[model samples]
Target: MVNLIYDKSPIFLQNIFISLKGIQIYRQRYNKVYRKELKILNEENEFNLQKKRFKSFIKYTRKNSPFYSQKLSHLKKEISMSDIELLPMLTKDEIREHVDEIVTRNKGLLPMGTSGTTGKKLIIYSHPYDISRRIAYLDYFKAKHGVKKGMKRASMGGRTFVPEKQKSHIYWRHNYILNQLLFSIYHASNENIIYYIEELNRFKPQSIDGVTTVIYRIAKYINKHSIELTFKPIAIFPTAETLTVTVKSEIEKAFRCKVFDQYSSSEGAPFIVENDKGYYDICPATGYYELERIEGNIYEITVTSFYTTTTPLIRYRIGDAVELFDTLPENYTQSDIKIKRIIGRKNDYLVSNEKGKVYSAILSATVRKTEGNFIECQFIQNKMDEVIINFVIEGVNDKKTIEHSIKELMKVRFSESTEYNVRFVEELESTDGGKTRFIINNLNRELS
Candidate 1:
């Protein structure tokens, strides 16, 4: 009779409800413990201990990781901390070339796919300990702003892979279980924007995290129409792309919260986070980060994660460019470094209709040639024949001259008869996660 009751319809529903509620309570308890542990780790001297741990991690990676071992094969066993650059920088191509060998055979490592914004998706494996450390870092940062556990977090990102026809209440409950509200970036239309706002108001999350473009678009909608959002979030963390001062200002105004810009990549470590003081702080436990110049002041960012075990990326060249500061600030710890701005990826290049290619650096230089601050730019190729340049100009300038110069530059590079369409926008957008995509090739073309 008891078994029959357990298997029955209404009784089963009750059982599920009870189980879910219990899980939520358990999660709250776990978060409390996690916060306590993180509080201890946030102490000043804790960073020094983390550095020692990082050194051991370096030694372990060199010994266990084949990819790092091969790259740093030339280095002496007694290499000092300053000799980190002696290890050859690993490129995206190199990682893709040796994906299988790069990943550890350890079962404890969790494998995840890269966002594939650059091109093809790459597989990355990280240890459980690494994941825990990452979570801890996040907790410590959130604690600084008093964002404790049980506070709702709204994430605007890739679509949840669940069936779309599922009931909204069910989906909402699932997200709530995870302490997150997942907003779809793929559907950022006006209708979806309203829906997102409604959901956000209902959830009343403490923070909003997503692609910068999507967030900016939402903010623009709210501002243009004067939509007064009743619910205010504590913080907005933008990730995945470059967050310009303009975009940051807009997001801060709309969300009514301090915008924190995160400089990180899926391939490497989550290295830097901006504090309340507008200074970028390096995540000491994440990795040993370095800025190497290929030419002059233009530098390539490199990172070697101490927490990674599945695939230790030693001296990995993350392709992005950065402007480095000469001296560290007094307020910042010795491990912390100041990065003026992350320019763009080295591989981010625009291909002309004539089959010639122009890198992002060239595009940036060309924009500068017109004597204007190019906030952000993206090249959209609809077909092989049609190319559109969408960019934002900083100051009052002759749009025609700037457009003409870009066309001339493209023509000089390609040597092909190409039609150039330039759209000068007031502001370029970023994804909700605060990432700016410079060149989006929609021509259904693949780079060989």
Candidate 2:
């Protein structure tokens, strides 16, 4: 049975419930033991450990799960990364189609959904074990940054804690259970922003976590208005969206604290965070990852979950891109995987004439699935009813093939009256964070 109460519960109560739930009890025990292992396990050792765990997981799925059993019936018993590569890539569409068959014979099943940066909502499954590890992953980084559990903190992501159209001074909801102050991002108007800052001052959270753009808005407001804060937070963790250099810099200056960025998905495949050493490091305890190069230096991240038993997301191709690092720093001899930048996930959007918003992820997936040697691509939307696709092609014998494919997909998803322009660009540009912006929507004004 699905419980909507837990899904919409305050973050603190949800965390408490996870610790007390049936399967989660064992998961908590397992995590208590595994935390010790995580301390000594270096990047290389963690890879080997996850490799062993992955093989076991595959065997478990093949014996029980109808989806994997049929998919891997022909493969040999000995599983290798190269051998796994031979298997068909799993997309979000496949999960939506085969959700019932993908689930394992496990209890404490939980339904989860992605924020849907790709235009379409993606529903995935998880269990107590998965949730435990996820919380632990963030806690590990929190500990590194001198943040402890039960401490005063504030979060201002996509959640609508405060309802819009309600004229009131209260712009936040207090969660006394976790000593957390939940701010609303939907009401980020000039008038509402003052209440948000006022609440932060009154509550005096030790740390703040929020969406990249939302937090940047608060920081920009502080700088522009010269609004003096009563208290300074120890650290700021920006998540959900790409963290640009300008956003990070402005946030650090405004809050007088460090910014720690992180990346992950609802699929529970791989957990990654900005380490204290200043690099995007994958949490070895979370899952295994295989990087598939889609274009020049830009690779699509494929992941397999090690924690979840209800859903086996093996070799799942999440529609996000990242840039690989060529060399490692001399001091960092522990990490095997080195990632310099995360280009971005599909989070761009388009607005219709009637103010209907369309996700950029829909367009990104369409072009990515096309059979062509496109080196790089970006979707730019300046007007409400128009779109410009800026793409870089290495060399294609039939350029018309690419154009036809894009237009064909566009026609199906968008209105016939919408104006579409395909522009062939020599090179795409990167953001201040040294990462490429896949979806650029200038119409959605940034914080001044």
Candidate 3:
């Protein structure tokens, strides 16, 4: 009777009903691929196979990729896989400057625009094969948690404004297409949340993915209202932003499910995935990653994606700082490497009050503990005795407690005489299309 009523309902109402059913069918198809991927992940000798694959990719990039070939011309030596570091790390600026030259003039390649946090956008081209590989990687990760393809996926991302009538319906037609209930991050608000939640309950997706900040906001609303949300997703995948411990906890608490963090970028490949054990493991099939230290122990991440043939970003300097749990080996596999933390961008650090000094991970960790829902934080040191802490917090809190905590934390982390002032304000914004930087230091004027 319910099926007959839904089938015979008015066009407007029928569309909603169809969308909800389509989502369920999509999840089932996705789950099958997920299971197959999990088996591959657990296979022995996978690391050795990945290493062999990487070596072959390096050779391919050196020959086909003009950007890499030009850079390697100076090193008049046999280019082995180990010689990857010898190549200069590519940056976003370089890509923008040499956009046409970097991209292979080939058909069946897709172009993607990266909306950087700084409002600077970069258009990158990728081969269709590369896109398929990315899908495979997602499938592999999802399978570990028993997520199926036919299940509906709600994405809290930028592209949700498309009208229901005009938006692509191929996903709905095919159960294996991974049905997406796209919710716009740009429009997330009280009213929007209510509508989104209601629609989501109707759609009942198996999982959700997208920016951590937007997801956190929705989770906050759900928790605040103490709403008994019936749409229990199998997993929540957060990408594009720094997934702090606090945000992760809150999200998990609200959704009552495990939260998986994915570390990826437009220039390179999806590099990291959190396992059931809560440890971030490198994706063996995607690319190779290395950490290079600039000052003291502060490191910058360099990635070389094997699958990026259209515009190979060889030894790409992603500009982000990271702390590794395991030191990379001369001939290492994915299992040999683990990331302890992503320490934000290299530019998002402050100079220490101590002469001839710098701060990175320690400072970020300190500010992260302060009382606020901050999108970004920066320390501005104009003089030896004074420092201004520019921050963006979501709502009201104990300012006195926060200030005192920051001051005490800074004292212990840096020089004692460095008195501080906390600037609490809303709208600590992001680069138009990029992740927010949690820490910024203006003292390094020349560097800025």
Candidate 4:
């Protein structure tokens, strides 16, 4: 069988065999989810079907999950979609504290966890249904960009394929199963980045999928050195971190391809994708999304995954903020959900002593104008008055030039009283799950 060949074949032949098998498997799974999605999509009232699925999910969780049973006992008397919303929103702390009770009949479940960027990591189980549905949606996104399964692709993200300590020759690992050339973010540097460029040029992948930081760094290097790519990718996909305008522009210029931003989490609850129309289109089938307004045009997103029965995330309050749009734009492809833009997390803003609160866009613009040579940056704040700027230097710039530029930029954004510290680093580290955080704030102040 092809599956047997994929498992037992040597590395060289494995890419071909695995590509064939992966296509067949993805096709079967994609059709299953696609058929269901089409049924909901064609309906005159889609929320009516969503409501039914939500009720069934609530019943399944209440009957099997001990944690949900106790939490939803009050609503058991009169179950409805409106009543489900009345239940207390699930928090990451609650999930971490009662992971065992949250899981239901874990016979064929896979354990998973988040990157723990906020100092609280949630551990849960991945349901088989969730995995299949996720693959189907991923295929959908790739199809939109004219990509098919088993295509030669280059990926640079959080996975530690090459060990962090080994930095010299081997900067990449190839996966025969997916026909992918995996570039390690840890090993990307000035002395070693050329090897990554060489491997990418050698593979000539049709698509390059990676975190924004890694992809941006590679793109910046290529542009700076005026090195032309051997082969052009049809599309560039960015995930795992927030995609900024500056990075997106740089990446598009470097690759000479359109960049599609894909947003999802390990929790398997929500899915958002950048469509050809330049909109952050949301998929309604993945989760029931609810928005809580924090300020002007900014709302906190809370979601409940309809497919996650093993460890159901119902009304889970993930700390993410986004611009609000009540309706989708004209000529939009998808339906039922609308998000104007993702404004990073609640902690991405700086609580200035004078300017009230400054969002990531403001800080990003300031840094881009001042320090254009830095490939990547992270703004860290531990207090209201002090800000630390962490940057990975790509060019040979003196310390004083970089420091003075950052200080001048900070003065324009924050008050003159606010202190600035600039730290030059070799590379930024990704979280345990391979996600890179652009902004890290340790203070306990409320997000405005």
Q: Against the true structure, whose lDDT is highest? A: 4
Model 4, range 1-448, lDDT digits (tens) per residue? 7545444545446446435655665555556655565444445354565667777888888899999889878765546566655877988778877979998776868777553344223567975566766776676678778987679988875543343234348766666657788776545545567788888888899999976766877888899999999888999898777887888999999989999998777777668789887778766656677777778767777888776778888899877777857643333322535677888654666766765555444454455446445556677788987988777766665567878887986775555788888888787645455756666766797732
The root-mean-square deviation over C-alpha atoms between each candidate and the true structure, in angstroms, is: 13.8, 10.2, 13.9, 12.7
Can you tell me which runs of candidate 1 are displaced by over 4 Å?
A: 1-40, 44-50, 67-79, 115-117, 161-174, 294-298, 325-336, 345-448
TM-score of the candidate numbered 4? 0.68
Of the two candidates 3 and 4, the one with more favorable TM-score, higher being better, is 4
List model 3 lDDT by residue over 1-448, tens digit each: 8756754555456556656665654454335544554455567355565677677776676677676677677774456556666778778788888877776546766777553433234568975556555666776678788786557788765432223333322212212234666665534434456766666677887998876766777787788899778878899998777787877888998889999887877656647878887767777667777766655444576787766768877777776776676556656644556677666544444554352233333454455545534444656556556767766555566666667877876764555666787787664434444544444444535421
lDDT of 1: 0.62
> What's the distance in Å from true for residue 128, model 3?
1.5
TM per prediction: 0.66, 0.69, 0.64, 0.68
lDDT of 2 by residue, 1-448 (tens): 2245665565556545543452434445346544654454423366677667777877887888888889888989768554666677788788877988888865667887542443333558886666656666676678789887678999885543333234566656665555666776545545457778887888888899975655777788899999999998989998766887777889998899888888886577677788776668887656777776666666677877777667887878777777767643333322546787788643365554432444443344455445555655666777766888766876766467767777765654444567878777787655556655666677854323
The models' CA-based lDDT, in order, is 0.62, 0.67, 0.63, 0.71
User: What is candidate 1's TM-score against the reference?
Assistant: 0.66
Worst lDDT run of 10 residues, candidate 4, spans 159-168
Candidate 1 per-residue lDDT over residues 1-448, each given as its tens digit = 6434333434335335444664754554445545554655766564575567556766776687676677667777755456665667777677767867776565765666552433223568865455555666776777677676558787766432223333343222224455766665534544457767766778788888877766876886687778889789988887665777878888888888898887767655746778788757777656776765655455666777765667777777666666656543434333556666667543354555433344433343344334334444566666666667776766656576767777875654333477878887775444455765656555555442
Candidate 3: regions farther than 4 A off: 1-44, 73-78, 160-177, 294-298, 326-336, 345-448
Clashes of each: 19, 0, 23, 0
Error of 2 at 382 (Å): 5.8
